[model samples]
Structure formats: C-alpha cells, structure tokens
Target chain A: MTQATRVHVAVPNAPYDVHVGEGVLQGIAAATAGADRVAVVSDREVCALHGDLRRHGVDAPMLEFDGGESIKTLGVLEEVLDFCAASSLSRSSILVAYGGGTVGDLTGMAASLFKRGLRVIQVPTTLLAQVDASVGGKTAINLAAGKNLAGTFHQPHAVFCDTGLLGTLSEAEYQSGLGEVIKTALIEGEPALAQLESISRDLGARAVTALSDTVARCVTTKARVVVSDPEERGARRSLNLGHTFAHAIEHAAGYGRVPHGIAVAVGLQLAASASERVYASSTDLGERIGRLLSAFGLPADLEELRSRYSLGAALTANALIEGLGHDKKGRVGAPEFVLMRGPGDIELGVMIAEEELRDLLA
Target chain B: MTQATRVHVAVPNAPYDVHVGEGVLQGIAAATAGADRVAVVSDREVCALHGDLRRHGVDAPMLEFDGGESIKTLGVLEEVLDFCAASSLSRSSILVAYGGGTVGDLTGMAASLFKRGLRVIQVPTTLLAQVDASVGGKTAINLAAGKNLAGTFHQPHAVFCDTGLLGTLSEAEYQSGLGEVIKTALIEGEPALAQLESISRDLGARAVTALSDTVARCVTTKARVVVSDPEERGARRSLNLGHTFAHAIEHAAGYGRVPHGIAVAVGLQLAASASERVYASSTDLGERIGRLLSAFGLPADLEELRSRYSLGAALTANALIEGLGHDKKGRVGAPEFVLMRGPGDIELGVMIAEEELRDLLA
Candidate 1:
C-alpha cells in the first residue's frame, strides 16, 4: 500500500481531509468510524469493478445505479434521497458516495437536503473527480435550462481518492481527467505546473504514484482557495479558470458528447488565447499550456476538439457564446470570464466586450 | 404606522434583522436596497389584498400563486426556482418571499438552491410566519413522505413582519398563530409569557400594538435560540418543544385539516402532561397552558381538537406514535421529545418509552 498524502480542506464550519494514494480506499473505515449508520451510494459499473462496502468489512446498506452526467438531474437526485430515506439514514448517519463526479454530485445534494443536512464522505473513482470535483463542496444537478443550474455548497465529511481505481478507466476517460489536472496546475502555478509538465507521460501511462501526487497537489490548491472563499464570492472564482468556456462548449456540443474534462482542455487553451489578446501579455502561456495538453494526447484547440468529438456545426463559435448565457456562474449577457495573465496570475470576473469575444471565437 | 421593533437574529455568516410593526411592509424597499434585481413571490390572495411590489415602490417582477400547505412540494418549489431564473436573479439579486409559512418555505428553499443561493428578504404576511417561520433560517419544501422533509438552513437577508397584514386572517387562522405564540411564550418564560397573558384580549381583537409587541417578543426568543445554535444540533432542539408531537399529530390527523399552530397547541398540552409524568413534577403547568390556549380559542386537548376539526379515529395514539417514528429530528424507534420541567427549564432529546407516550396520549 502506497503512503497516502492528506490534504486538509479548511472550509468554515465543516473542515475535512482528502486522502490520495494507491490503497487509500482503506481509509474509509477511519473516516466513518463512529457513524451510527453508513449508506454507500455507488455507480453500478464501479461497484462491479471494485466490490462494494463489504470489501472493506463495512456492514452497511448500499445503493448502486447507472452513473453518468445524465443522472445528474433533480429526478435522479430525488431517487438517491429516497434511497437514503428508505435506508432509515438519520442525522448522525454518514453517506459514502462511491463513483465519479455524477455520483458524488447527486449524493452530496441528497446529503444536504435530507433532514436539512447530513454528513457525506466522497470516494471519487475517476481522475476528474479526484483532482477537481471531489475537492470542491459545490454539489449540483442539471436543469432543463442548463447544467448545474441548481446546486448547494455542502462540503463532504472526507474525500478518499484511490489512485488504484484509475486502472479501470478507459484511455479517453483518463485523458478527460488530465484536462482538469492541467487546469488545476495552471491555476496553482509554480511547481505544480512544472511538475505536471514533467510527469505528463507518466500520467498518460496511469502511473499510480504520479497520479496520487498530482491529485494531492490539485486538492491542496483547491482547499486553499475554498478556505479563503467557500461560497465562491471572490477568490474562489479563480478556480473557474477555464470552466466558463468549458461549460459553454459542452452545452453547444451537447452534454456527454464532449467529456467535461476534454472540453476543459479546449477551454484552457481558449482562456490562454483570450488572455494574450485581453492583456497583451508577452508570454507564451497559451503555447505552453497547449503543448502540455497535447503531450497528454488531449485536444488543446477548438478545431481539434470539434474534429476529435465529431462535433461539426453543433459546436460553432456563436452557439458556444450563446450557451455562455446560461452559465450558473454568470449573469445574462455579461458572463464573467476567468482570464489568465500567466500561470498563478489569473483574473476573475473579467467582462470582455461582445465583439472581442466574438472575434476570439471566430 | 406603528413603531417597528427590530429583532436582530445573529446567525453565523448571515445575520439579519426582523422588523415587526403595523406598516413594516414598507421596509421592503430598504431591505432590498442594493439588489440588482428583486423578485417577489407572493400568495395571490395576499397580493390582491395588500397590493404587489408596486405598493412598496419597488419595480420587480412578481409571481403570485395560491399559497397553502399543499403547495409546499418540490414541483412548486421548482416553479419558484424557474421563475427566479426567468427573472434573471443573480447572486447579487434579492428574492422577497411574501406570504405565509408555505410561501416562505417554498421561496426560501428556492433561494437557497438557485445559483447555489441568493439573498432572500422574507416579508411574512401571517402571524404564524411573522413569529416563527420567517425569523428562523429553516427553508423547506414538503415531500410526499412528510412535511419539511427536504430543506436547507439558508438565512434570509432580512425579515419584514407587518402586523397590519394579520388583520386579514380568519378567526381560525388567527387562533392558529396564537397556538405558536403560546408555545413561544412558554419556551421564553417570564415577561414574554406574562406579557402574552396580559395582552390576550388585545391580541385576540387584532390590536396592532399588541400584535407588534408579541411578534417582536416571539422573534426575540427564536432569534436568541437560533443565534446560540444555528444548526439545531443542541440548544436549538429546545425550540422544537412541541414540534415532535405536533408533527406526529399533524401526520395522523392529516396535514391541512388541522392548522399547524392548532396541532401545536394540542402537542403542547401532550408535552406538558408528558413532562409531568416523566419528571414526576406537581406543577399545574399543563392546566395553566390549557387555560391560556382556551382563552385564545385554540384547542388545548385532543378531545377538543377532535371536536374542533371534526377529526374522528384517524388521530389515534398508536398512529400518532407511529408518526413520531418519522420525526426528522429523531431516530426511527426513539423520537426525541422536548419535555419541560417548568416555563424556562426545557429538556431536549428526552426519550419516553412507547407505553408512557401512549398513556400520555390516552
């Protein structure tokens, strides 16, 4: 068992720890030590691949369902909450979310609303979830109007990111997580970005040690930002370095067509390009990030993204810009864009003129 | 225009003032001063009677729906959220919940969930709402399973309790509000209780000054308790004095049939009786409370409640106890009961044996 690296998220009122390593799944026992009742909600595929709670000697009820972006809806969220109610889970109970981002999102939401709120432990199974989704306290469900249009800031009791679980991810899915890793590394600046650039090949090969270190770094950066701005009121918005464009791209290409992390990869490049134009900075930030993303065999440009996903006319610049109007983070026409001056020098709530945005998209 | 009394609810992270007076509705403008957009969700009846946002010189879009316990469902809550989204309410915007408890519950729940939470200014139009629901940060929407089964602790930006609005309440509705008033007074003890007893005649006659003072007193008690324990983990349970039994009674008697406050009046009597038996105290506390409730024309006993609501065998002790199993505050078998040793001395999480509870109900 590889030694797990722990990152403490100091969110006010509900501070918790994140464990990242090869066999860190074993940490679940300690995380839920004194919980009167523990309910594990997992993706059926993940459960099939890596046994259920009993594998860790936990005698608790488990709910396994098909997990994906599609399941992040109010209906599915209600189903999860119903399962919680049926399991007779109480306030003192702990709910373990065992899956990718979708399962964690649904379970976190259910935990927040069930009897006004309950403790939740996240066991993220995917790379994207481990590096980003699992660390943030933002839990959401997509509405017909937009993705993650409705959500709550319900922090987890703990997060366990087992690098060993990444072995089962498909190559494309693995690359999807690398998208968020690059985004996090960019936002983190310094050694994190340098480290990611150096270990790009090892990460692509699914090296457990590399993955664990990267996850720990990402979580540490996220935790610091979250502690400073738990509600995303100020400094936390910087974490959305590439999310504004990524969400728009995903919406234009139709959700689930372009994996979120992949879209984020393209978004990171877009942000870098916009930064160069907006700030006129004499930095090769865009080219450097592009090279790093390309090294991991991910799309780093809009043209590449469109070709890779077979997203032809659907992902047009206008459609992507139109989709921005629905971003949960922004108001109607003047959507807040997170622009980059360089690594660690990210600007939040930057309002680019419509024509400037249009020119960049074109 | 009576002088408005401000009760500051010092909940952590988001503290707000509750303004109680005859024309306090006019305070809406200042409560939502810097909000870029203000969306008013009101009861249609209340809107027709008291006029809409225009009356307060606020130019905001309004969604007026029929407000009742039945409308406190996820569907209505969703409509309210959709309305918010349609109104383009951003994080900086304010949502004014203008109605009774149902409207407040639904609107507050929506405000907490939309865009991960927005500012909400509660303009409670009912005495029950003014005294209890509006002051507390408990936002909820009922599920098919139970009342307030899904909720969040999203404190309002401010609360406007216009005593003038209570003039429109029916005799039964006014008495229902008095039930909560009596419960609040008992929990508060001393001057609050004494003041209520003294002003009983004036309050019953809808005297504005009396109503304002009572509302302010109740809010003060609630505010103090909420400030000490915002999340209902410890001392906050004391506020749930009659709620455990009250919820069970409502469940067995069927919701909407017995107004919440009336059910609470009966529940208070049951609690007082149970306290006597459990603590073996010889205080005529139950009788005194019974007399006070009787003076307000609220049912003080199960027989009177049965006669008042024409509720037959549906309110059996066994059924009510069964309902207790589903109390959100307790475990399945042993529901937490708040028993009182005296007016000020309230005990929380008291576990009464099933037989003892049955005997008390009998």
Candidate 2:
C-alpha cells in the first residue's frame, strides 16, 4: 500500500491534520513533529496489526489494551491516561487514537485530560470510524446505564483513514460499516440515494467505490454541520438523523453487542417508520427503506430483531423515546426527530405525545 | 456572606461561569441551569463539605473519593466517567468538579469525555485553585511516571472560587496558594506584585482588601493570557515563569508530599537564581525573590522540597534551561526560557548548552 495521505483538519481555534492512505504509520514521526512525545492508545487487535508503528519516531510510547465498546468505560480511559502519563507524554505530545471508534473515543478523551487538552490525532482503522466517529470531533466512553453518556466534542488535529486496514475486518464488520455508508448516502442528496439503489447487485468493486464516495460525502456533510455548529448548538442536531434510535439500540444491547453501524441502520428504519406514523410521510417510502436495508442484509424489523440480539427492554423503544427528550433538540420541550420522507429527503419530525409513542411502538 | 462576595470566573466558549463564595454550593444548581442529572467528582474532603450540595437540587448522585494530586489518576477519572455513564447524564446534564486543582482537573477531564465533552462547571475551594488553577482551563491527572503526563486543556464553562472554603484550608495549604498569587503578581506587573507581597504578610481582615484585589488581578492576568493564547501557544508561556523548576521539584518530591503552589515557590526561587546566573543579573535580585517566598513561609531551597517529584536527569536541568521546550517561543531550534531579569521585568532566556546547565545549577 502507498504511504498514508496526510490532511489537516482546520478547527477555527485549534488547527490539526489528518493523515490518510497506508504506510502512514511510518510518517507518524513527522506527523507529530512539534509534539515532545506520543501516547499510542489502542486495543489488542489493532496493536497486533500495527504495533510497530510506535518506532517511527512519534516520540510517544505505544499503550495497548483489550478493545471493545463494552470496555469503553471511564475505567479504560483512565488507564490509557495513566499510560500516557507514565510515558511522560506532555501537553506537547501527540495522543494517537490507534484503533476503531472505541479506541478513538477513549484516546481522544485521554488527550483532552492530559494537561487540559493536548494535541490529538485520530488514526481510524474502521470504516465506521472513518465515516462517522472520526469526523465529528466527538470523543466519549460508554457507561453501564447508557451509551455515550460521557464525552466531549473536542476535534482532532488530524484524522488518518488508512483504507488498507479494511484487509483485517471480518465480513460482518465490513457489512456493519456499510450501514453508516448507506445512512450517509441517504442523508447526502438524491444523487447518492439513487446511486446506492442502482448498485444493489454486485456490491464488490462497485460497492467499495460507492461506500468510499459515500463516506467522503458524509464527511463533507458532517464537517459542514460541525463547522457551523461545533457544539451541536443548532444545525448540528440535523446530523443526528438516526442516532436517536441508534443510541437506544446500542444502550439496550449494552454497547459492543450491537455494532454502531448496525444500530444506526436499525435507527434509520425506526426513523423511517416514525416519520410515517408521526409526520404523515408517505407510508410507501417507509416500506421502500426496509427493502433497501433488506437488500443489503441489514435488519429492517427492529422489534423482532431485538429478540435475537442483546436488547434491554429498559433501553429499547421506551428508553430511546425518553432519551430523545434529553437531546439538544429536545430543548423546545419536545423530541424533534430527524425523519426521511423519501430517498435523499429528510426533515425534522415533531415530537409525538408520550401516549402516541407507546401506540407506535406497539 | 453576601452573594457578591463569591469568587466567579467566566470562560467565553461555554459562556462558562465559576462562582466561589461562602455558599457557592447553593449556586451549583443555578450555575448548571437546573440540569436534572449531575456528576460530581471530588475527593473525600470536598465531598464531606459539599456533599449536601447534591441534595440541594435534583437527585444528584455524588461520586466521591480521596482528594489529592495523586488521586487525579486515570483510575479516578474513569470512575467518575463511569458514574456519569451509569447515571445516564445526557448532553443536557451538568458536571460539577467540587474540589481543588486535582478535583477540577479530573472533573473537567471526565466532563470532556462524557458525551464528547459535557457542560462542566468547576467549584474550586482552595486559595491555590481560586487564583490560578480555577481560571486558565488546564486540567489533568498525574501518571506514575510523572506529573500531568496525560491530560487535556479543556476549559471549564464556569469556575467557582469559594473564598469561604479558604477557612477550611491549613496554613501550609494557604501559603502554597500564595506561591501562585505571587507568581501571578510578578507576571501581571509591579503594582500587582507589590499588592500581593503586602497581603502575603497577613491574609486576615486588614489584608482582605489586598487579597481580593490580588486575586482579581491574578485572575485577570491568567484570563488575558488564556484569551490571547488559550492553548499556551505563545503569550501563555508567560504564565509558566516558575513552572520549569516547579515541575522538577514536584516530580522530585513525589506528587502529594509537597503542594503544587509550594513547589512552584521553590521553582520561582530557582528561576530567579537561573536568571541571575545566566543573564548576568545581580544575585541581590534572586535574594529578594527568596526573601519574598520566605515571607509567605514558602520554601526557597531546591533540594529540600517535599513532593513525589522525579525527573529524567536531563529534564531536571534541561526543561528549566529549555523552558519546557514546548512553548511557541522555543521554535528557534533552541529552548527559550522565560526568565525575569528583575522583579516586574521578564525576557526570553536563550537556550543554553547541557554542559552549561550544570554550572548554572551549581
């Protein structure tokens, strides 16, 4: 694979760079030039794959642990921070999130805590992370009571998406990634949705290209929203399209049990259905969304599917509806949901009465 | 007892406010805008004093532990984060860091990690914290290898410096705080330094006016630096006038044995000595700096300080001589030390060779 491509993410007050492509690990030294040290945070899996990258003169010590969203607890973040501290990673050190979303989230947080916010670079190895988690500048860990209850919206100086890392993912994991790709495409515009629908068959070479294009497109969309509303103060709420339901699914499943993209895919279906029921969207459009998910082997029947998964009754439909009340958009005294009327058409759905929510779930 | 007597700090980004007064605990709810869920990270001592603050508002589950710099570990940060997650603190919820620097450091960090950075308000109840730690937006926990090796520069939305809390502090802790006040005064200007020096004698009723003025001046000095260079990029380096040697002293004495401010006092004395030795200034100025520290009962001897402080032999001498080598002024391929030629007069000290460092230290 070619050397990882480097790209700088310009955050108004804090400017950082993102290194892409492959063999980017070798460039870590140069990437972290101004940094006095580097603290490489990763889990067992990614460390096994690219652990050697620490020697590239990054000036940071490589710290690894068993990785999983389930383990994305405050405990793990603290451990990673201790490792960074033990390594003498100063404020000038580059904290590299060297795994998937879980690693990225925790590492980013560790950087934020070291000296009250140090230079951090995201090295996202998962397609889900590259497309969604790594782009938004949000870093967090899960708690027993909920998913992502603790986190910060500190953006990274750079994000490195080495597509070559896809070589290691299981098919299930790769497919899990497609869920976000599809979500992004639908959120983009009519062109993206039509393009996705047209390539239902043979998502092999065409699939990779489509997915990559969709990720870039989604990145641009999320970036615009983030730039405009870095703290989710206003327009950024639009990016939560299906996250409301997804958070519930992830929380109900107790994190890690449901891959983020899979949960997001389920969330999309719920949003589609909720749109039909609450916003009076075309019912046919909701059914079409199910078909598209089914075509991609994604779970469309979220209720029935919950039984097959590790779903917590407390966190599922009931908790999700309640949690939406806590979202920033809920400030208007209602959970304004993001809905899809049709392919590439999304609008904010008004909050349904609690009584109506129970009926819709039923 | 008047509400206006409270010490308040406002950070612009979150439009953050920190209130430090006799009954600031009652203000926590008001500061947080009545968020239903609250995550409070504090050590045993702080929790005891304001544990009831949790009951003042909603059902706020308090997370308490030992209060000290060493406890500002990743383990503590994680535990607090776990509490936030377990409690289902939403984006709308607020986190209160209820303690001194360590508590503020970890609490701010945990807040930053929760939901990718939550709205956090710091309630600093120590003189050291009130005038310095509570204002500049620096937060972190110490690692086994050194002090604040892993952390972030996440600013608190608000800071509370409850001067009433000072009534609970021991004389040693109170004097330690003076070290910071002195540092701030020296950097602020001649008027501030003189005022601070006068209050250093009797921090009682007669000196209350001087103390308040000193605190305000110090806070403004830090606030101004943060505003111009919040991330310690350029002008902020001025704030680290005594930190190079202070860090070494803290490291050498171990973390908790010697308070941060006390070590900073020693560091200040050393910095003055370095200034006289390196810049050819008269040793009389260094003696004056030493006498000023002694007036507040702060240690001026470099080797006699107590704290779990350790240093990479090179760092002990190099970091001070090099001004930590991370400041923006150090870009000339040489360490630029921020040194004072005389009281109220500061200049960038050029990088000296390692061989020359031993002579200066001697």
- Local accuracy by lDDT, each model: 0.87, 0.67
Candidate that would win on TM-score: 1
What's the C-alpha lDDT at position A338 in model 1?
97
Clashing pairs in 1: none
Off by over 4 Å in 1: none
Candidate 1 C-alpha lDDT tens digits along A109-198:
999998999999999999999999998789998777778878899999999999989999988888999999998988888677888888
**What is the lDDT for B164 in model 1?**
88
Tell the DockQ for candidate 1: 0.60
Candidate 2's residue-wise lDDT over B1-362, tens digit each? 43434333344554444453445556556766667567666667865765545554635677776677767776666677767766667667788777878888788767766666666777777788888887877776666655765556677767766566677677777878888887877787777766665666666332545555555566767777677777676678877787766665565545676688887887787677777767775756567667777777676666444222333343345444443432223432344567887666776544655566566553
Model 1 error, position B210 (Å): 1.5
Which candidate has the top score in DockQ?
A: 1
The CA lDDT at A275 in model 2 is: 78
DockQ of 2: 0.37
lDDT of 2 by residue, A1-362 (tens): 44333444555877665555545556566777777666677767876775545555554567776767756676676677667646655556678887888888888866766556677888787777877788767877666555666667678877767666666776657667767777777677678777767775544233444444445555666566677777776666666777776775665555577777887887777777777877664667556667777877777767645765736464555766665554433532456678776665677645667776666554
